[model samples]
Target: MSRDRTRTRERSGDAGEEFDAEFELDSELDPDADEDRTRADPDDASGGFRSRAAERAGALFAPRIFIAALLVTVGALFATSTFIPLPGAGLAGVFAAAFLFGAVLKDRRYAETVLSGALAAGGSAVLDFAVVALFGGVGLPLVAVAGGLGAVVAAVGTYFGRDLRKGLTQDL
Candidate 1:
């Protein structure tokens, strides 16, 4: 067999012998090397899927003015239902006022307005139950029925109120 020769370097450590190996540098890291490498566009944020997802997630928690308004309206409704029972006649006006207020001054989203109105109605119902429990002899079943009716009425009225506002705006 013909003699073969190849230069190599090795070091003997306490554990074992280690050989040195050569590694090639990437073209991008080698400044002196001429090569074409694609770079991302600085203004192209739309290319990232997470960017759009993050924006949508942020929109869900946007501040709403109607939440405080709902609580105040609920308290007022409770007082009315407690001291002045008018065969549910006052409920219509209260719900209508709340809906108009939300439609005109608060967030215009349909779901938000309807939910606020529903919550206000529920709060009024709870207050009615509390008053009855403390002072009156009405049964729990009756209180639940009344509360459910109030919630339904409020939700329906609020939906119509928002629709009316949208219609008026479209007409003008």
Candidate 2:
């Protein structure tokens, strides 16, 4: 059995020979493919243009600054609700809060944006749920469904905003 195994190993090693595979390169290339290789004009300061929203979406994130911005936004929301007495403020505040949170804390990464948006929207939904339960206006089912939708909106909005930041960074 040992001799047979050794013979099999030797046969396999002999069979496993290296071969250099070669292929002919294409001597003729499409002219259209080469056209895209042209460099931008030296005089043009901007190498290429991306949307403004994409540019600002790339802003740096500092933990301290993010926390401060969030606190300010929360305070503003409370003040706006108490002193301003604006209708539809609750929904607006939620969206605005998430947007502000994302604007301050979100990095260019989509995952981070999504996470921030989800947290903001989730917080807003919880608050909305509590208000509804206390006030006894909107039903529980409606609140639940709307909360889910709001969360989705917040995440999508944050992602787009962050994506726009990339272009903004390039401009600066």
Candidate 3:
């Protein structure tokens, strides 16, 4: 006995989603006029200018330093609160810890990166949860606030720490 074969695929892309399939009929059925199909370039990058810019941004920022910093910040904040008295001083401690870590241990900014991630993730989540309980739902705004704070902390910490190490590296 002969059997027909069919293949089905569910496809999704930046533009949209689709379903495609190929089928084989035994003894080959004649092609139907209604079955006409057109082909489009799968790898086409053509999407106007800003669409292209968005694509580029997604490619660059979606996966790179920003995400890394967030992850690092949140992790660092969680792993250790460190020691600081004032709220402002607490933020300073966070940054200073990262800076000191990047400077002293020469730890390849892993310490700082984790710090940023922790701050972004944990600190933001905590703040949001706390505020929500106190003041009611503020929506997902907390994520943005936390993320922004994390980025600032990570960038400033890494920048100053790296800068501090520049000439000092010569001595060591």
**TM-score of each model, paired residue for residue:** 0.46, 0.37, 0.40
lDDT of each: 0.56, 0.47, 0.54
TM-score of candidate 1 to 2 decimals? 0.46
Q: Report the lDDT tens digits of candidate 1 across residue range 36-123.
A: 2222444554544466577665554333544654664566566666677775654664576566664675344444444555566555
- In model 3, the Cα lDDT at residue 87 comes to 38
Model 2 Cα lDDT, one tens digit per residue, 34-84: 223223334432433333334554444445544554454455445555665
Tell me the lDDT of model 1 at 73.
55
Off by over 4 Å in 2: 1-80, 83-87, 106-139
Q: Indicate which candidate wins on TM-score.
A: 1
| Alpha-carbon runs more than 4 Å astray in model 3 | 1-89, 104-115, 118-135
Candidate 3's error at 11, in angstroms? 52
What CA RMSD would you report for each candidate?
13.4, 16.2, 14.5
Model 1 accuracy (lDDT, Cα): 0.56
Clashes of each: 0, 12, 19
Better of 2 and 3 by lDDT: 3
lDDT tens string, model 3, 37-111?
A: 111333443534446689766654444544555544444454454443333333454565556545654435553
